[model samples]
Target chain A: MADVAPNKLRLLKGAVQDNVDLVRGIRTPGLGRRKLLESPPPDPVQRKRIRRLWLWSPLSLVVIAYLLLPSPVVSLRQTAPIKTFEAEIKQTPATAEVKVPETEPQAPASEPHALDRGVIPLAIKKIVIDAGHGGKQPGAISESGVSEKEITLDIALRLRRLLGKTPFEVIMTRQGDQTISLDKRVAFANTNKADLFVSIHVNWTEPREIRPLETYFVGPSDDPVTIKLASMENQESGYSLSEYRRVLEKIYIDTRRDESRSLAKNIQAELYHSLKTINPELDDRGVKMAPFLVLVGTEMPAILVEVSTLSNEEEVQLLTNPDYREKIALALVRGIRSYASNHNGVDRKGS
Target chain B: MEETNETFCVGIDLGTSRSSISASNGERHVIDSYVGWPVDMVARKVIKKTVLVGREALDNRLMLDLRRPLERGLIKEGAKKDEDAVQEILRHLISLIGLKQKSKNRAKLRAVVGVPAEAFRNSKQRLRSALEGVADSVMLVSEPFAVAYGLEALLHALIIDIGAGTADFCVMQGRYPTEEDQRTLPNAGDSIDEQLLKLMREHHPEAQTSIHMIREWKEKWSFVGEPKKPVVVTVPVKGKATDFDITKEMGEACESILPPVCETMLDLLARVEPEYQENVRNNIILAGGTSLITGLSDAVQKALADLGGGRATVVKDPVFAGSDGGLALARDASSSDWEKLSL
Candidate 1:
């Protein structure tokens, strides 16, 4: 009946602004401190640029590599940061258009944001395998009590074992049943200097029978289903407004698009071909593109493959089998091997 | 010559199992958060309606495509029908309070809705989208904060709102509770029902039970610690109605929430400033339907003994506490402020 207190008014204002910010898809101001804690150190942007520069120019790579090397006594402090090679692009328009036929790989593109093609293609040495959901975030559950978190973790661990036999260095975003925020996972992958990221997830579809083996690369998607899937997967992303906006901006222009797409295609193909032997009902949903938070944040080529659908009771039954999980892991290895062999000419036996 | 729209304010607690609304015109109502449509021509003909909501939807669930849209106090993600069901639930609640959205609408509607503490920004945005055509303007706040506001416990009060979907805890430091000042646990009424059903099956293998029946049993007989009397319910046993004494099962199911709830309560209490910690501990308020469980407040108070003794007050009317608090907030906000919050 009377005026609210001054402190009440201030609280009301804060509440109103927080609500408005959520409606506008802007991160709440109060969460800024927590976001800072989750975020990586400030040097990543500079370090990423430097890594890209080294990839683009061999001469700069030699000089910067020497400077970056640990000295015996005197630790060299980086005072003046070197500018990214994008500055050189402005002066050399002819060189931008010419695709290197000998060393460069993947599709040819003149776009400045495209993956650097001047450097010799290298075999993916470090692969960061992220298990989709864990801990409190039980992504999807079936009536039989099987959860997506457990299934993904099992498959991820299996994949790690299979990859252990190969030359590829495997890094798991989560090695156990623990809740890791998407931002933290991204920071882990980036910090570890992973050359590729493969996130494993299980799908849950309606009507229970539509089991699809799908893989996704980082790119904008117009499909409603894909958009919904991305939205669901992006829960508890823990990225602030500025970081989210930056990721959104890169969705279309990401330099890893071509490599990720190629990887997705290979994986999807292998998964469908290998999995259909065990279950003929499995459909190849094809390599589609959506801006999954994991795929968006990783600097290297990344793909999220829905290895199989847990929604289907029969598929879930198969997924529970150790041999079936082994087959899924093998299919993934084959996909990676095929992609590696094609992209960088790294043979499965040689690597 | 212009027609001016009359303004009306509303407060809504869009909960997981139940939703309550309080309007400026002294109309208050609560409904089960359910929405459904007739599954077939026969169902439509028999029900005499295209859509059913709340109790009606629950009663005629076999004949309807029933949906309890809110999962853990937020819209079920990636489900289009569930999203529509949430909208329908809101629309039904608004209509129950006698505000028509389309009848040459003369009244400007401003609503304050309560969501779970620590709800994601995306979930809040989804809730906002669900309220699009229902209200002219809307403000969303945490359910416990709304409860605290309505109680006028402005400073140094802890509100633990245990709803069907989530047990939301908020420590009121005078200002609107931030992410740090609040916590949400999934251990609430629904979890109790689940545990009860599981235990019932384990205890009486012959007794057939469903979630709906378990929910009803929990609402009637749920309690923590010692029960005043044995809880006996008549359930179907091998096609015969038989009475089963589930006192032990009921106690186990209800008390399952004690450890997490007590731990989180103490955790949040410890986070409060040292000088104000005593006041906060003494002013602990419990709201929401689950708080109505017998001896819950006493059990929580017992847990507080470890923290040098404290007080726990159960809200007299847990059902409308959030809605009333939201209504209080809606009434307090000036017209100018509401204008900026247009949906």
Candidate 2:
């Protein structure tokens, strides 16, 4: 019984060795079935001991058979159909009895180059200036009788002239005093691929006394005060076009909102600095957000400037001066230039 | 300047009679729109806090000097006596609205508040600054526009918001309304209450009536034109039961509130284009608590008909309609770029 126990142990060892050989042979690179057979068994004495246990101990034989048989079958079951065909070779009598040696392969020593060569350049090519109101819509009438349409147009034209020397191509949503719809203004920017959009107007107040310089951005996701101003400016141009409406919806979903915000901040900063420098008493009114129909559907970064309160007597008087208009235009141009210089690598993709 | 995706937006409806706040992340709450202060040392000793706000302040009328922030639906900014009361009320109201929530930090707060349509420019700014202290962003829209946005009627619709102090009218033209589209009239539920108080004093000299009692009577039996049954009430005059006739007085008082409402609606109707005129007429929606008056719709419709020819309608749910509309606008506006709205 003691001899039988040692023989059983030898037989189990042999079976385990055979399983390892078969797994290694199948996994070994470039080795075929014939090559596996060319290798000799580890020892003759061990083989005899395993053979003796198989002949004498029936219980050991049954146990060894029970463990060894299922492993190959389980491995075969687990492997994919293509691998199963390769695994079948290990179950063959001659292949199942041998041990196979594993080999290590060395990798070659050359460094690979990057797929992308260098950084890409993003340049502002075109800008769209949208004068908020035109034609039939006179917009807010100042105490001094300055119309919102006239102020916006004056500012827009000045901005266009300031950008004339720059690389940026300038486009005006409305060149003359003609009524242009909000949708049309947005469409012009989208079609032309305008990098930046600026709509200009003047602020108004009830009791015709309050005066301030405010800027607006569109809302839904934009700030409320800005949206109100934009809405107020857009109200002056009442014409609504369905074609631009679709484009506007698309622009709203685009990822340019963040960039638009950055542009707004820069413009607000520039405007605030310039306006404060000119008149310390002038209310900074700061920057606000709103859902302005004109700004809403534009693909580019957009801002609407309420230069000064047309309702205020002093402000309206100043607004009529070419110097004041020039100062506002110069301040806006400076703001746009600063924004463009800082965000040179960002893709504005304006027409 | 801090833009975070997790920023929360808040919509607050600071009504003349009551204030409610709703959050973009789904929270809606209301607080009484009143502030109170202890009148004397005895009252101050009874209540440890120097001030009280909302329902508690309103209920404790005798010991506290109650003050409403708004008069005739506009903030009484420079009023001398109610300074402390207003500030305390605002602080309490802001705290209750959870202005200190974690969302206040990570969330970009865009607060849309409803003010009277005809609010002065300076008054709007003062109100904006007041709200801005508690919010990251503040947007002041007329009360009627908020109601219009609440109802999703941005185009070809008229909003008639009848609150305690004023009736605000606005015409929606497929966009956020401009100043031209809005009008406010300083005649509403409070006006009716005042009329009732005056009429009762004239008719029943011995009958006792306070503004509160008159307001309660107006809330209970206020109607224009006629009611199915006449209203009779017993008054406590010098702690004695006194029967009074309030039917004619209530009807007359309620009727007096209509002229301004009709006149504003007519003005709003005339401002819109002739083509959209019929649509605006058909889509006239009445909102606010005062609009809950029994025969208001029919009477207002009759009034409109008398002006020219058109239809007028009241919203099915007046109480939550304006706030709900503001909430809807906030939800729709959650993904909007805040910078695009600044002007």
Candidate 3:
């Protein structure tokens, strides 16, 4: 071994005759047996390691898949853009066992970080603002003859101005008094990869005295009251009530329902707190579950806010005031910030 | 009006703590009145059902919206999102009685559901709505009255039926015990359980104790006058199971209701016809699941001794007393006794 040349390396360090024999590490002898037959074969331990790896590789692949892939590929692909709740969650330090992939779209760096202590910037980019009941569809009319569409649009624009100060990308379903189809509104949000979906609407019931500030997340309407609200919002939509359960079933796998509910609760709380002074009688109905077509069709954390019933005189007067509308807008901005504050970039690949 | 095989009569003690239903078909069931609905689709799939009743409901409550629809022995009034749960419990009990739909004439169900003493008319109306589709004809009767009816102590016995919810006291005066003859207090087994739960939680903040655990502890180690022995049990604190001594707290919670019951018992005795007051005081019947608490009868009798001589007696079957009485009433009730549905 010491006599070997500097540039030379060999499996067997004895005198070699032909170049082919040296390269192959085998030499022919006149004993009628192979020349290197007497030499040591490959070490049993090293050979066994290679053999074991080959034997266990397939099983390891199955185990890895079982541990990581919690959902189907088709569902992920369909909801890839807007459904980032689980994907974002996977990025947390608690989930060290699963590794998130890098190729997924990242949150914008300019956006305000979540308030969650030491959380990474949640990639909240585009947000869709849907002012309910536009054009021919006059949402709800107040006792004083104020249209719900006007109130919603006014508040939505004000919200746009408030959010404009931040790095977020806000998209309005309709910039003016125009009718955009339900499919088109949700499609616009999905197309833009909106992180959050907020649809603004006013509530209505018989006798016009019901005054409540409630937020709704997409679910099977739990009661007749919820069904009535869903029906009122889902009037023009082509979908039927029969399909509501299916929509809820699909949402359960998407992980958006939980986020949507949290968003609703946050927004509902802020709205009640801000407006409680303007209308002392304003009732905080809290978060509710309903199958509104606008929410069910969306693939994002969506909530429909029944800001205040137009039937109540106090609330109707409150909605009519520009200062009150601005307060409502500011409250909504605060809620969105709170909900998105803890959202951070998480690697959701194989989740 | 005569006894007929076409109709099935069921007597039910629809209590907040426990519910019991006894049918004419000789089937009987008593279950913890806990109902829960799965929280989401994943839970529904994993649980393999939408609604769960009784102990199963409590065991899988994490993934459910657990609804205890009754409070103070009446269907919880003003409690939102409880209608479905109330109906589910009613339907489950009726099913346990085997209301075979395929049978001829559909076996018209005429149920007499025993309720808390002096239950609100609104509560009975709510209960009536809940029982609409389940039973063709139904009647709501005071719980203690039902117990008195079954025991045939309808003459002059004072019934103090202590249950998980309200403590019902009724004066059986030969005729039906009217609302004026009964008193319902919102203090009983459940209230004690709650008090104990609060004490346990406060005493050992790190202990993982729920209402169920507190209830179990109360049932096994409850004593009024004295502990007699150390009332200690192992409870999971933080993560490790550790021995916990709750003798003082358990004793206090169990004894909290005694004063009210004693006062009510004295008041009812005073109100009784002066002639029958002696008999009523002597024959005071302490009947109900909560009456099983050791020394409770003696505690009552001791308290009652202040207002002349009195003796408190325990029932042979506290659990079935109310239902058995309700069954007796249902079988004896005339056609006019049942509430006729408009349909």
* Top of the candidates by TM-score: 1
1 or 2: which has the higher DockQ? 1
Q: Model 2, which residues run further than 4 Å from truth? A: A1-351, B1-5, B80-87, B97-108, B306-309, B334-343
How many pairs in model 3 have backbone atoms within 3 A of each other, for residues 3 or more apart or on separate chains, i.e. clashes? 2
Which DockQ values do the candidates obtain, in the order shown?
0.15, 0.01, 0.00
lDDT tens digits by residue: candidate 3, B1-343: 2237767788899888789998887888888888998999999999999799988898899999998988777665445567777788888888888887545678678777888775533456678778878887766667887788778886788999999988999897765454346777767898899888888878778889978888988888899997789899898877798998888999989998888788778877877889888899899998888999999999988987877888888999898888887776666654543422211
Candidate 1 C-alpha lDDT tens digits along B1-343 = 0113488888899999999999988899999999999999999999999889999999999999999999888887667999999999988988999887788845988899999986655567778888998898899999999999899888999999999999999999877776668878888999899999899889898999999999998999988888999999999877899999999999999999999899889988887999999999899999999999999989999999988999999998999999999988888887777777898
- Alpha-carbon deviation at A168 in model 1, angstroms: 34
Which window of ten consecutive residues has the lowest lDDT sum in model 2 chain B?
A: B334-343
Tens-place lDDT digits, model 3, residues A1-351: 344222221211111111122123232221111122112333898457435544543443333233233445324434443234335434543223111123321222222222332333346777889888765676787644567877887788778767876888887886545545564576677877888999999888656676877898864432566666666676545332333334433432444666687788779878888888867777777777666767877888899998878777677766655557878999999899877764542312212
Off by over 4 Å in 3: A1-351, B102-104, B339-343
TM-scores for all candidates: the values are 0.59, 0.48, 0.50
Model 3 / residue B278 / CA error / Å = 1.2
Give the C-alpha miss distance for residue B35 in model 2, angstroms.
Answer: 0.3
For residue A324, give model 3's deviation from the true position in Å.
Answer: 37
Instruction: State each model's CA lDDT, in order.
Output: 0.79, 0.63, 0.70
